[model samples]
Target chain A: MFLREFWHKLGSPKWFYQISTGWMIGFAVAALVLLVVGMVWGLAFAPADYQQGNSFRIIYVHVPTAMVAQSVYISMGVAGIVLFVWRMKLADVAIAACLPVGMMLTALALFSGGVWGRPTWGTWWEWDGRTVSTLVLLFLYIGIYALREAIPDITLRGRASALVAIVGTINIPIIKYSVDWWHTLHQPGSFSLTEKPTMPVEMWAPLLVMVLGMYCFAGYIILARMRIEILLREQRTQWVRGLVA
Target chain B: MILRLFFSELRLLSRNKAQVLNPLAFLFLGVMLFSVGVPSTVQSNGIYAGAVLWFIVLLTNLLALDGLFRRDYDNGVLEQILCASEIPFMVILMRIFVHWLHTGLLITLLAPLLGLALGIEAHALPVVMLALLLGTPALSFIGATGAALTVGFSRGGVLLALLVLPLFLPVLIFGANVINDAVAGIDNTAQLYWLAFISMVAFTIGPFATTVGLKISVQLQ
Candidate 1:
């Protein structure tokens, strides 16, 4: 019964707006503080790698962004499933809001990965497993966004994009596995996600902070977009009119 | 009932001999472009031959998928089937099967000729055909979902490619790998097994998703 009421309240845009405003502010401030501290520590205070020297500092941005990129896609998949099963308007909003954020974050991860690679691998792009998977993730994002644009009807667009997103979710694991296999067979001496990082605690701690900061930042952006979507979708409603007037 | 639907679709599709021949012609031209245009020296290398053949097969599959459901959907045939059948999902599955039969299987049958054009050795020809025979059904199954989603749109050709091509990568990777390994005189059994596994999964999930997409398209119309 309590769960039911919570779900009902969640479906209410007005209630969501009231609750998320505080969340949005809190997360924005938290993300800002954490990112600043983490960056300062990682860039200046963290000890340089014995092998990689200061060039290794990029991982503080690279690894965290890469982690969040995958997480954000998974969250969109969950939202897609929720949209189909419950027909909740908020779930659709979540998917709509996450695509751009996920796309940019994935791009950031790829860019940072490339930067890191230039120092470590002697090249800007290597068709390795993680890099190829991230590239595919970017393409999937483009596909979903394109599908949404092609369909004109709002409800139909929601359902169609939702289905595409869901199918993409199922394909992600297979893609990762196949890319990994292809990479292993094609290039024996290459970076892989399975290798254990030998970095010390001091080196990794700031990365932990950066990852948390990035997640909070992504949440704030997604929620802010959700709020704007709510307003746009509900512009003609009495509650929205009263709030505006 | 399934046979009745299957035969009817087959009969209708066979009447339009051009549609059946279209993908085959595309496959032939695509192989000629690569082998003839790129010069013989590069084409004769069995490894490149294997990759080029699989890539051409993938593109040809995409070409054939454009009409998988558009004609039926446009002519009110799909709508009537949905309204009349107790299980409309079978209609989609059968359609995809017939599509694979015409485009995919025929391509597989003709793959040896393309393989020879690319200078693929005798040992690799069987593997190339085997990979296509196993992997192409999955393409049809997956393509059906994209077709169903975009069937409502008047112009869905490029959009369907965007939506479906990324999903085709794994199939392409495994199928190509199967032949590439064979050309290198390595065991390709593992890749073939993975290709079969993917096809099974696509067969199970494709029809259900396509049915849902078709229903949505029909309802929106």
Candidate 2:
């Protein structure tokens, strides 16, 4: 009865599958609204950087995507921890779901950062702290995806890849602080513990909007992917048979 | 018990000449390819050698050690080793030791040619060798962890590199730092000592984590 009770409550794939679509719609609508508004405001209307000119506008995309990349890693790490801690099928599903979403954000970060660099730094690429370390971040994502796809056994692959993601958290501070640590050409953190951000709220407001939008998009994708995973995993269950009928 | 387990691994390593040779050759071939791949400009002559050497070593470590646990896992001997009460932990420790003995030693011994291929000067030979000596054990120990984690998979070598290469960053950084010291005409005794310190730390802590991974792989089967 406890198993049945738990199944009726949290344990059932059918229940999760049923509830997720609602979450996905709410987040998807919110993400679209925020992302569109943020992009229009930042790219067209925001005041230009005194130093960087119009190229500074790229920050709305770069900052949001970079923040999303790192946080998606945390998201994946939590999914991994859940996978191991509870041995939940949905947790594993969540992990596999989030990997690509994390990767897309990493690509966006790298692309926008490179584009931003051209007008500001006068180079196509630089091995400065942020670029090099972010390159390593890209490698970590690729490695996780490649490792999972390359492996045959589902759960072993999941566990092994999770360990990789967890270890990669070590790189987060290194990525953020590599400039300060190495004295590289890249600028130091905009927001400092010892001091406030260099720019006013008018400058950072659009960034906040875009960052929240990216997070919602990330959440929407994970929920959507989890729905597919539940369906595939529960194909043989009675709930699926009833729903299909 | 540890000695017997270690030596048995040594014997197994000695006997499997192809497995041993593939990675050793890869370490050499990878370095050679890099030298030829990059134009032989003046800028390429000095510190570049160390960077290339460390990169090749990381790649070789991945290709070589990817199968570290898979073969034992597939053979089902890992299950026996796990269920065996004589020394479950030591057995896992033995496996790691053997992995190091093969790939790590191979990298150190082969470094001179790789250094030469990369246009390293003769004066820097001792520095490069010493740096490899200082850093390769950590590669083996860390590589063993990656290998153990990925062993149950079908296509693991690339994934192994992905998982293992990030862990190898400090080694690559400090390893390159030591060799760069020589090229820049800086004294590197302190750097080499620091690398040795990190290698010792990796050696001590890496095996237990590897044992956990190995035990899980065996259980899954």
Candidate 3:
């Protein structure tokens, strides 16, 4: 019952705004500290790969951004479901907040992967499975964003974008699988939960930190954006007017 | 009632000769552009021909999709259908079925001729038709959802392509791979199965999503 109440309370924009300030600061600091520590360790301290040397350090940036980019999309999909099933307005806000950030991160992942590939694979780009799927992902984000921008009605916009997000989520795995089956020039992922890490502790430990930091950073950015969106959306409300004034 | 609706849709589509012919013309034009742009030496490559054929089919399907719901929505037929039908899902499903019959099925039938023109081997021509036959309905179904979503906009044509093309990638990949495998004398059952699986999924889900989209569009109107 307590958990249910908390969930209900979290749905309230005013309550969310009131509570998220502290969280925003905490996440901001945590993301900064963790990312700095992880980047410093991974980029400067970790021993280089014998084959690719220091060029492999790009993984520290590439892996985390890629992982976080996909995670944000999945979360938006979940948010899409919540918005549809529950008609929770905050869920729409969450999607709106996270979308541009996710698009940027997906772009960043592609760029970093390309940069990493130039040295390791001797090409900046290849039409391989992972790369193609990631490009599709970026397109998916842009499509949803464009759809949202095209619709002026708030309710229609919310529902249409939510539906697209849900459908895109279902298609993502199928796309990945089909693209993988079509052609696979990229190496299999180095990180998997079911198996042990291929690299040593010194390398992966920093990666773990980087992953966590990226998540924290995403949380901070999304929350900050949501709070502002909430205010703009609710600018006519008494609480918002009082807060703003 | 469902059969009546389906036949009526077919009759309505048949009345508009341009609606049916334009996409076919576009398909022919697209193929012509590709044949002209690429050297004859490259055109004979089976893999290249297969990819080009699949891409042109996709674009042709996309060309036809913009009109899928726009006509109905514009005339208030969609709103009336939604309001009157006991099951809007069936109505939307029938609409998509009729759409596939005109666009996807026609394109599938024409693919062999186009494939030959593109220098796909005589032996592989059957595979091109088969792949397209298995694949184009999925395109129609998936593209219908985009059409439904953007049915309200005056300028939804470009936006529809933007939204639907990415989703079309898997179908395009599997469909083209089936032809490529067939060209090389490799068994292509797996790719055909994948296309069938995608088509089935789209068939099941597409109408429901399009119904929801229609409702949203109607509500806005």
For every candidate, the chain B TM-score is: 0.95, 0.93, 0.96
Looking only at chain B, model 1 earns a TM-score of 0.95
Among these predictions, the greatest TM-score belongs to 3
Better of 1 and 3 by TM-score: 3
Q: Which stretches of candidate 2 lie over 4 Å from their true place?
A: A1-26, A151-154, A170-183, A192-195, A240-245, B17-22, B25-44, B85-87, B109-130, B149-155, B186-205, B212-221
- Every model: iRMSD: 1.0, 3.3, 0.8
Ranking by TM-score: 3, 1, 2
Question: Which 10-residue window of candidate 3 chain A scores lowest in summed lDDT?
Answer: A182-191
lDDT of 1: 0.85
Chain A TM-score of each candidate structure, as shown: 0.92, 0.89, 0.97
Ten contiguous residues minimizing lDDT sum, candidate 1 chain B: B38-47
Candidate with the larger lDDT of 1 and 3: 3
Off-target runs (Cα >4 Å) in candidate 1 are: A184-197
TM-score of each: 0.94, 0.82, 0.97
Deviation in Å, model 1, residue A153 alpha carbon: 0.7
Tell how far residue A55 is off in model 3, in angstroms: 0.3
For DockQ, the strongest prediction is 3
lDDT of 2 by residue, A1-245 (tens): 88867644555567788877789999999999999999999989889988998888999988888878878887787777666676766767877888888888888888888898899989878877777666777787887888777656777777866666665664445344433333367665554459777787888888789988988988898899888877887889998888879
User: Of models 1 and 2, which has the larger DockQ?
Assistant: 1
